[model samples]
Target: MSMTVARRPHRLLTMAPAVLALGALFVIPAAPAVQKGDDFLTPETTGVLNLEPGECFTDPEYSPAAGEDIVLYTTCDQHADNQSYGFVHADDGPYDRVALADFGWTSCKRGFVNYWPGAAGAELDYYPILPTAETWADGDRDIMCVVYDPRGELGGSMLPRAS
Candidate 1:
């Protein structure tokens, strides 16, 4: 006499969504604390002079206005609400606020798309942290490209997701 054997079906595709949901929950605890303000120059922000490209941080009160002190810096993989894509230098001599603003706008706009190719129409937004007229004369000409989520607070790096 001979016996027949039966095989079990795999549930890989059916389990995908559940696995993804569980994986996402891990980063939820790392979310940065959101701070709102009337303007970006709120006293709540601690001044940080040097923030390198790919660095991540949280701005309790983020302001697009130039000249404000840098905000608190945090780990990109940990408690980061925002990240810096890159820095662009301004034109030499006769530092002008208007010209700097225009340059920052153009540079940041280009850099944003480069860093986040799939960002078009997404909830993400970016702005440039440019030197104020006073700071510019003091030799501060770096324009920092910053990315953040306006819809809500974020807890992890925004880089890998774009890809």
Candidate 2:
């Protein structure tokens, strides 16, 4: 199960269509009342920023121009489109698309390795959800690292189990 990695820029106009088609775009909305480590028995629409590590969700519908995206949180035991592996924070600086991408790439790759230490050969792929300039100005600096199986839905949590 080797890992495949890809980077998905957040809300860039040029890449918006590709991001939406890949279900990588997450909408901004009133934060959902979900706590970290909670299991979502049923799907619920929420902003991407609301997602926490280990949470599983369906691909969200995003309107780039509207500055919105929606992800449906679901149980990891169920088949889902993507999972939140971890998050990275951009350094304190003016938003530079290229700089952000580079930071996200390096951070996400490192996070992925730490998250799945022995799963280097896992059949998984990952990408980062970076903040757009608008979102950055609005004080959104999170880069979410998402893991998914390119072939289809993830049937269960990829986190290694405790012995």
Alpha-carbon lDDT, every model? 0.69, 0.70
- For candidate 1, the per-residue lDDT at 28 reads 52
Top of the candidates by TM-score: 2
Top candidate when judged by lDDT against the true structure: 2
List, residue by residue over 113-141, the lDDT tens digit for candidate 1. Answer: 87778785576777777776667767777
lDDT of 2 by residue, 1-163 (tens): 9998887655598887787877744655654332221122111234566788989988766657656666768888776878888888877789897888788778887977876665544566677777777778888888887777665677899766777
TM-score computed on alpha carbons, candidate 2: 0.62
